[model samples]
Target: MLSGAALSRFRKNLMGWFAEYQRDLPWRRTRDPYRVWLSEIMLQQTRVAAAIPYYERFLERFPGVEALARAPQEEVLRLWAGLGYYSRARNLAEAAQEIVAKHNGVFPSEPADALALPGIGAYTAAAILSIVYQKKLAVLDGNVARVIARLYAVRGDLRANGTWQKLQATAGHLLAGRSPGDWNQAMMELGATLCTPRSPQCLLCPVSEFCEARKQGLTDLIPVKRSKRSTVELTLASLVLLDPRGQTLLLAPPAPARKSAAANDVHTLVSRMWHFPSVAVLQGQAAEALRKFAEESLFRGRGFRLEFFALKKVRHAVTFRAITIFPFRARVAKLPRVSASKAFPLADLSTVAVSNLTRKVARAALALN
Candidate 1:
């Protein structure tokens, strides 16, 4: 609980240091709520370096809220294909439409109003409103949380809700009222560059004199790490059926079956996107499992002999699920007309909205040829 002269000195040191050393991010160049909101959303689980290109390209394609709202969902997903966490792109467009319809294209200034948007949460609402509208709010993201924990020598599970709330209070208390935007950015910059999680450069920190963890020689020990969820390993088998005209077959995930279907029937990796016909398979039986799946579902009524070649295996992950994909390709005179399946030009797959896992599958199958 820093206060009085000590708090004033801490604020001065942090702001002065920030003025001399903050990174020149493109988002910092403007106070536009839309751009700031977009950057905040994109930065949510992505690294800064990986997010910059996507941010620039997304802004170029849909320059403003109205443009994003007007664009088709598929097109937005296509442009955001490689960036992953596709729900963010979807919600961004939905929230834009919401702004246009409800607020007449102006970003909501009120904290509650901002939080009412599709993907905006407490931290997001606070960050966007503070940085763009100069609202007196503090951001307590992972980096900022780490800095706060180390500053006060906070110990225990920092991920715990009670611990987190205390850190948020500390952050709000330390916020520089007059320069809320710069103050928030300065705090984030300090955590990201100097107060890093591992091997923090305490000696170079602008506020080292005020850090309680440094004073107690606990800089490296404070801020206990959060436990990770256990990974679930899975095996997936996919079929890439291509016709002589260079079109590849894709299928919508099958509807959940009742208990009547074979016990071996597999589940699709992703839903709501077109993907190669695939199924989860038992270890060491990928080929046999896919053959059975294709014969029963893909060629049930149609009379076509199945001849397939195995392609390279692809490894992918979604959240805690670690997957190893066994891809098989078959050349046919023409693709079968299966229900819930469609054919797209293989060369133009980029135009379609598909998961990164699907993209990896396509790349693996293509690379071998």
Candidate 2:
């Protein structure tokens, strides 16, 4: 904890550094709560450089809370297709509708009302309220938490409930200066650019003098890492069927449960989105499992024989799962009349809302053709 004089000097140094060095982000140009809210949601689990383009494109489409509230959920998901974390887009649209119905489309100024919205938790509520409403609340996101952990030399599982509450308290105490918004961003910026988890640039840090972890030469060890989940390797066999018209068959959400013995192997890699017919396979059973799956679910009563050729494999990782996808392509004489699937032109896939995993399978299949 910083003393009165020390805290004052620390705030002055941090704010000065921020004023001179803060990157010009698109969200910083406006105080609109909707825009700030979009940036906050997009930046969660996404890099700044990656989120900027999505943020601009989303704003261009929706424009405001009313527009987003009025838009279909599918359209919202379509705009957020490549951003990943589809739930964020869903919640953004839902929250917008809530604001329209319950709050007349104006973002809530009260912290409680903001927190009541979907996907708006403590950190998000604090961030938006402080930045847009000047509510004087402290934002304790991952970046801010890491920065606080180093500043106070806090060591332990930072995710532990007790430790997290203490850190939140400390963050609130350190909230100084007239601009809580700028102050919060400065702390997060310092953590992102200088106080990184690996090889932190202590030499360039403006608040290094106040960082107890740096003073003790334990900056690297402070903010102890959480235990990592063991990676589970999974293999999925996907079939991409194309008609003579060059239209590809894509399955809709909630794919039928695999009746194969490998049913338990199925994972939630792809959510409720358009995707190729895919099934998890045990080692050395890719061909057999997919054949049975196609026969049972995709090709049943469709009057088309399933003759498919293997395409290049695509490897992807989602959180703890390392997935290797076996893509197979087949040309059909005509489109199948399956209720669970739809045919889309292979040339233009951007019109549909799909996951990155689906796109990977499409790209791998396309690369060979």
lDDT of 2 by residue, 126-245 (tens): 889888988889988888899999988898999897988998988889997488988898988988888899889999999988889999999889888889989878889988888888
Residue 365, candidate 1: alpha-carbon lDDT: 71
Question: Which lDDT tens digits does candidate 1 get at residues 265-336?
Answer: 343355345688888888899889898888888887476577878988888876777888899988888888
For each candidate, the alpha-carbon lDDT, in order, equals: 0.85, 0.86
Error of 2 at 21 (Å): 0.4
- Angstrom error of the Cα, residue 77, model 2: value is 1.1
Model 1 scores a C-alpha lDDT of 0.85
- Number of clashing residue pairs, candidate 2: 0
Which runs of model 1 end up more than 4 angstroms from their true locations?
252-268
